[model samples]
Each structure stands twice: as structure tokens, then as C-alpha cells.
Target: MKTEKEKMLAGEAYLATDPQLTADRRQAKKACQLINQGDYDDEAGRNAQLAALINFQGSFYVEPPLYVDYGYNILVGDNFYANHGLTILDGARVVMGKNVFIAPNVVISTAGHPLDKVRRAAGEEFVKPITLGDDVWLGAHVTLCPGVTIGNNVVVGAGSVVVHDLPDNSVCVGTPARPVKSLA
Candidate 1:
């Protein structure tokens, strides 16, 4: 069986452009067109378009004009809601649990470019899967980094940068995301 790292690298290779690979940008472009049109009213149409755009499982809703990079890797759960200006750079898989609520200006990124200049220049990138558990609420301007797993019933405050895993039923805030208190 392929390790997660191997799988991630393979997926990234599929997304990234190289002489050997035909990059899949169609899904992302299609999603952007549908969202930018601002004409989706019926629940079925909106959901169908989004599902086509992304690898969505279960039911979820996204407010229009939402920007998602490589939408083919995102998996949204039932009753998920993301407000305006939500950008998900889902070069890797982004899994969100049921009843999750995300405020405006929230950025969740799965692809992490290399810090080293040479490695970055060589077209090397690291992707880590981001997972948000059930009933999680993220406030406005929250930025979630790669490989972060937020536990169930977690609430992340505005302007927080989550760089590490957060335990269940915790309220996390501030840069680097320290646990403020337990919600349980």
C-alpha cells in the first residue's frame, strides 16, 4: 500500500504541470465560472455544479464566488457552510465533517511550498491533508495550514493561524493556534 506521503505526491504530480503530465485545470475553471455567474438559485443546481467542480461527499453549501484552487480534491460534509471570500487551496485533500461552519475570509491551504529557495525553484512542493471534524466553527480570517486536524465541536477564533493539530471540543485562537479553552 502506498503511504499517505506517496499518495499525496502522486496527487500533486497529477495537479502540477510538467512535461510528462497533463494538468487538470478544467474542474477549477468550471467551478469558478459557475460561481462567478451568480445565477444559481435552486439547491439541486447549485449542489450539482459544486459536486462536479469538487470531490464532494455528502451534502454541503458554499456561498457564491468562493475561490477553491484544485477543487477536485476537496471533500465537504453534510450541512457545511462557508461564507464569502473563502479560499481553499486544496492541492491535497481537504476533508470537513458534518455541520461545519466557516466564517468569511477563511483560508485553508493544503499545499505548502518549500521554504528552501533551491527546492522551491526546482518545482518541489509538500501537500498535507487538512481534516476538520464534525460541528466545527471557524471564525473570520482564520488560516489553517497543512496537516492540521481539528477535532469535533472545535471553535477557532478569528485571525487564528492553525499550524498544528487541535484536540476535541477545544476553542483555539491566536497565531500558531494555542488552545484557549475547552468547549466540552
Candidate 2:
């Protein structure tokens, strides 16, 4: 039998309340809380809090008040930067390439409940990986839905919701984010 965590990584339905998964989430949340509430002047202390859950690449900076379902499922390349109020529902893998910039209040979700109320009530949920290529920038209040693979050199405008894949060298905007201009 596959463990809940395994199922989650495999893009299968799983119960979030499973003992092991619950424990993992709790640990991640604790780390997040400590990082958020810790002294702003104590940079080393804050880094220590995220040492276990978040892995740092070459150079990266994420402002406080970050939230994640499972921090282990998120991986970022070099030079990744995120502003305050960032949330990642990383039930599945979330990979951000190098030189990625995310503005405030951005949401990257890989976990979602079933559309069927019965399944939802049963506590069944699914996850899909989200990928952001290098040189991408997500504006404030942008939301990236599950299973999206955004290409490199792409810019997403504020308050946009991305539901599909975006090609490289493009500027996307609006609710269902469409390419408004090509940077190619």
C-alpha cells in the first residue's frame, strides 16, 4: 500500500488527515511560524527556522509570513525572491527556476479538493506539480493553479490567475492569464 505522502507525490488522491501527513504539515507550519514571528534583526535565527523545511540555493530571499502545505515539496533554483504574504500549497512538487521573482500575496497551489462534494466530504484531495522557468516574475496577488508549466522569461501581471501553460518570452495578464505581448 502506498503511503499518503507517496500518493501525494505521485499525483494520486490522498487524505490530508493521515497521521504521517498531518505530522509533516505540523512541522512545516511550526517552522513557518517561527520564521514569521522571530526577530527581524536576527537573520541567522530566521534562517535556522527554515533550515529543516526550506532548502536554499545560490542566493534567495523570501520575506516573512510565508505559508506552505509541505515545505519539502517546494524547490527553487538560484536567485529566487518572494515578497511578503506568499503561500504555496505544495502537496505536489513546486519547482521555481533561477532568477524568479514573486511579488506580494502570490499563491502557488498544487493541492485541491475534489469537485464532487461527496469526494470532498470524504476528505479526498489531489495534487499536481507546478513549474516556473527561469527569469519569470509573478506580480502581486497572482495565483498559479495546479499543473502549470510557465516557460522562461515570462511575466505575469498583478491579480491574474493562471490556469494553463504559458510559453517563453511572454507577458500574460487578466483573470485567465493570456499572453498580452510577446517578448520574443
Candidate number of the best lDDT: 2
Encode model 2's per-residue lDDT on 49-82: one tens digit a residue: 7656776566777789999887998888999888
Q: Candidate 1 clashing pairs?
A: none
Q: What is candidate 1's CA lDDT for residue 145?
A: 96
Deviation (Å) of 137 in candidate 1:
0.4
Taking every candidate in turn, the Cα RMSD to the unseen true structure, in Å, is: 3.4, 1.0
Instruction: Put down candidate 1 lDDT per residue, 1-184, tens digits, no spaces.
Output: 6543345556553224442222444557666777767566676787777777876667677877678766867888888888878888876789999999999999999877778788787776678889999999999999999889999999999999999999999999999998889888
Clashing pairs in 2: none
lDDT, candidate 1, residue 179? 89
Show where candidate 1 strays beyond 4 Å: 1-15, 19-22, 40-43
